[model samples]
Target: MTLRHAAFAAAAAMLLMGPAHAAELEKLWEIDGLKQPESALYDASGGVIFVSEVVGDMRAKDGDGQISKVSPEGKVVQSGWVKGLNAPKGLGLSGGKLYAADIDELVEIDVASGKVTARHKVEGAVFLNDIVTDGAGRVYVSDSGTNTISVLESGEVKPWLRNDRLNSPNGLAIEGDAMVVASFGKPAAAGQEAVPGFLVEAPLSGDSVRTLGDGSPIGALDGLVVLGGGKYLATDYIKGGLLRIDQSGSFETLAPLPSGTADLSYDPQTKTAFVPQNKEGKLTAFRIP
Candidate 1:
């Protein structure tokens, strides 16, 4: 056989194997002794990582939450880089500012000064979980309690989308003109058990929100990161694992983590993923294929 033919055959074999057998997470390092770290954000230009720590209860307005700064090498640069927050969960960076989902408000901090400049209140927000920013610098946050996604733009915070179909959205990611949501699934109703969550795609310009694939349950999903080529990496908050979900909504567990694997951050350029193990009080870094 010709060399080109052999290469094509090998590639076809890998495609047939699917992501389930092809993807594996290699552990790089872990930083322990965190205070219920819930989310991580990697700043490529700044060469650092930011972690939100819920020092106390997850739902309490105790004002003990803090953000930590860590080096790429797993060293804690500053344990309390920013404080005076009430259970901050998600972190996003844009326009030299850092935005965090703090319970019911969007907290904005100057990345250079590490000072919180503003806190935009979401009127009906119950438990704000994840935050993401688009290329235009507009910020979007998910309220898991209210099943809503709110947006902050032009100096105003308002509800962008609210629907029961969100099913307790916990993570947010921007993909072109659509927003990919990691649902935590709806809480159990009377005489009914809780339902496992699934990936949802909501159009940014329309009201159509639909399940990604066949409406099948994946897990109580949390963090969501777009890996391009119609692929995503998500963390299951309840099941405690990393998942590789395709555009068709089919998924395979990539890593079996501990419970409370909350909002994770992926640096595509470096091919690294940072996971905040909320229950274990640790931040782990893994090299991804």
Candidate 2:
């Protein structure tokens, strides 16, 4: 049965370590009306949250996709659907514009117009995953297929950086001039479902695209968000837990999510972390202290 309303999906209280706040993390809403919820972000104006539904099937990846908005009152609604998309993931909203990363492309939705305003086909994007936007209007996208990250310049694809040190870079965030990345150190491919996660840092400079070799410790890092005061929260898919990383490169587990947490983002103004469960088709909301 479809849940009439979305509620908190919380597990048992956890014994946190290393000065971490143990505020209860709960499942805010379960997306029944969609298929394969992969990534989530907030709509600043309407007090709603948008989640990407990636349709993957038995023999092939269906790739027909959509975005659902959950209102402040815990109601789920279909906000927009992108045509010719292949599995949308990693989402961001800036200046009232919503940008999403699908399996092979990037889509921009004009919330005011309620139409697909722009679409960029990522060149050689095997798994276009997470995206982050600098408030100044610069957008960064992660392409896990080629172990690379790209940026959109004037609506055209530009090679940001490609490094073999990073593999399956799924989630992205911007901290000052540094590009914070969370990824599993393996190429995201069929038949290899077992790989631990890695959280690494790289300066945003395209020429100096070198891994810092130091970042938040994670397990199959899937999604990531940056919080106020230089802290990070990530979805660890391999260990099935949420990880908290501090500025000093120190980290610990916050809470254990279900088997399939695909993406996450934070609203610094509200201090709330938005989490998406891809396989279970659920969305979780957490208050990180």
Candidate 3:
């Protein structure tokens, strides 16, 4: 089989309700990692990088399952040691306060205090996947299990966009007054064709959902972020690579982010994108040309 067909087959396997470990991925970089390190973010002001080690071995770091901070020279370190979190998936930081979305709750941590200052309840949330903050400081959480988006305002948990039809909402992005989400379709069935995922544009003020590009062969569009100028950079789990989609739904292949990335972040000021894959356990950096 050709490379593209092989990737499609891999995605078909994923849709059939199998684990990510079931497939072998193309090597993106020469990096060795941990059990499942999901999402990553760039802290430009502090000159440090942060990534979520979702499920880790205590012998590797500590039992806290903290977010690792790697420096420019590849020196690895950690901060905000969150102890016994029920799988911290995606992380976001604003004004130096770190926000973590674990399966059960959204917790706020203050590095100065080294304590979880506040924790809020996410309603109808069976699994809280990704947590992100738009520049205005409003926090959004992708509750994948309930098919809803949870918003945090002034430290209070508020529900937003509850729609069951949204099958497997995997990633979050802000696009001109709406939340552009990538939906990976329902579980794959044996011998059934793998369902293709698409980018849906949902307004922030209300529930007006519209699909931008239908029948997207890229399949599982996970960990998306604005690439500036109304375009996006997304991780394609099925294809075992990264993808770039423009404003008009025109897309191009970005690069390889194999091992399935969870959440992605970019520093436009520096033109760098950080991809964190749970299965890869390695934080890889890509410079947008």
Candidate 4:
């Protein structure tokens, strides 16, 4: 069989052997009064959740963006907890600092005082989408528009990986020595819809990138959370759904969500997921089984 046909065949086999039943998604509570909530991060030590909101145009460097604090039980404790940001999309917490992926820079905020302490600008960065820490005091941010991943190590910012095959990488998570990325897909035209995304595993020690599963399209994948045992929970940004995928690239639709399901935070303790519906301006909590 040709490469394309072989890929399709493998995908078909995966579909047949994937999970027969979808997980139960029980709605918990919803937080309203948010403007384009883009990402959610759970603070385990503080027992709170921090959400990023792009109050203005995502590409525009307007100072209307802000971050909010939500209680564990789904209350907006402080809507404007930290303000004066510009289109903050993703968030990461490391070493008592909350890092935000702003339009062209990574903004660092002091977690204790909730104050903007530093801003590390990425040279030639256009759209920095997702931010994550590798548990080693290193902050990694994905620049989708530039097709690059920038790293902040030892108080410096530099481009770590620049690969055109990334295809507008969005959500990111560190798995072992590799960085698993969820793509937003390549744009069809200057002002057209994306081509649908998939998952890719890129090794931190090398420049190689390998597609997960049969390399078939998943969706406009947004946020990604590793669910241990070689499984993951991902969000489809355009199609509007939550999905569970195994190591073999087999996927099962867990729940259908509204469009604009952005970055998500999953708490394994309670089997709960905090999802941000940006266009709907709502933050919802769902129990996943």
Candidate 5:
């Protein structure tokens, strides 16, 4: 079946398997006119939001991608805070710098000056999607194209793990000594079709990757955030919704969203979620109660 038909089937299946309790999302505000906004990062210290826009093709190196600065009150502070990127997706903040996964490179920007301080290329990387940073200032990037996870430390980038079992990892989140990965599932092959992904845990110090729970397929997970108490909030890129997942691998759909919802950012203090609607060219803020 085509991707569109698959999406519809997924949505219908979700409705059939009703959630135990559907969490209501109060729409706080929305900022429109964005260009394929793929990821959002909440800067608590700066009291603002950073959005990465893939203005052109997702894999093109046309240098039209950029990061925009938005205010907490839903105002566009800077349309092109940091420009000249190549299909930038995920956004991470560490050591007073903003890191963006630009295709095969990690573009670093000084938070204060909004200047491109460095661009660390990932050798042989296909599509670098999501990024996360640990408390120790280590940045981890997930490459969806290569089913690999790479790390940046001491001003260098290197492949940390390359596991086929990762199922084309898309989002990365550091949880204590392990990194929780949101896989995009395997790519569509000649005789096989694409399937829904699941969550996995990879120890930071070892190569052993453990699949959470029974490894039941969730949707094509994109953005992932720790909701504390062994729970997580993830966005389903294919099914088009937000999911609340437990450590045991069971999950419930929280909210149905637009089809192209990409990476999600949450503000824990305010209990607000920022979702980037890539095809809609908008960033929506919702209060999760």
Candidate 6:
């Protein structure tokens, strides 16, 4: 065969096999009737999922916010498992407590009794968006409005990192000694500009910031999940999509959804992911491989 023919055949073979074997997300289930569900947490041991329902305007302090309990099979076990919150967003589980990021406080809930345990007010915080807990029991909460990260240690909330380079930090996760953050990009007025979001990494014990994924914007990122081994999954809130970013900062789209993918939860053992479609008012699960 001619060299050109052989090359063409090889290219065709790759095209045929690429998508068939590429990473994909299989829809497992979806739970509807949620009022602006914004975050999901998969509790493997309890076999339940906790979803944050931001009922009214995101910025309003309307005491109508709550958390809902759902089964792994996408059933709303209790629509209002915990109530009386104010614009709750991100959620993290540690020390037998569930820490939720409210507008300006880190609200802690007793996981066993579904009761409010403590509300640690972050001084001068605005739009607290995401929460994470490290192995040392240090709780980190991100403030998107102020572009700062606050820490809860020894019952005190203090600023951990404050840098303009954060660019509206939204979602956060702890990977080893580094803190992974999904930025909402530079803030802009409506119709003034279209600023794409990105990701960054900071040392847990230091104050340096490093951009991720080829230094290119990823489009209004929200929920971030570390998929182990220098890989991560981040949801695009504006585009309503999911992406897999490798250690080297290269990314690929796993799914393109409606424009409301908020905070995400994943189970490593099952390779299952739970995403709350905020505007759609639904909680969807997908099996990622």
Model 2, which residues run further than 4 Å from truth? 1-33, 57-63, 79-84, 187-195, 209-217
102-142 in candidate 1: lDDT tens per residue? 99999999999999999999998999999999889899999
Model 5 ranges with Cα > 4 A deviation = 1-23, 189-191
Query: Per-residue CA lDDT of candidate 5, range 154-232, in tens?
Result: 9999999999889889878888888999988865689998788999999998487889778999989999998788988
Per-candidate alpha-carbon RMSD to the true structure: 4.1, 10.8, 11.5, 8.3, 10.3, 3.1
Q: Tell me the tens digit of each residue's lDDT in model 2 across 209-287.
A: 4453464335778888887576788887655677887666677777777777778766777677777777676676767
Best by lDDT: 1
* RMSD of candidate 4 to true structure, Å: 8.3
State each model's CA lDDT, in order: 0.92, 0.72, 0.70, 0.90, 0.91, 0.89
* Per-residue C-alpha lDDT of model 3 across residues 1-289, encoded as one tens digit per residue: 9999999998998899765552332333323454466777777777776666766541232345656666633456654445655567778777668888777578787755557788777766777777767888888888777778888888788887877556677788787788888776665689887776767778878477777765355567778888777688888766556777876677877676574766777778866777766676666766776
Q: Whole-model lDDT, candidate 6?
A: 0.89
Between prediction 1 and prediction 5, the one with superior lDDT is 1
lDDT of 1 at 241: 93
Better of 3 and 6 by TM-score: 6
In angstroms, give how far residue 98 of model 5 lies from its true place: 0.5
lDDT of 3 at 124: 65
RMSD of 2: 10.8
Q: Can you give the lDDT of residue 23 in candidate 3?
A: 32
Supply the TM-score for candidate 6: 0.91
Cand. 5 TM to true fold: 0.90
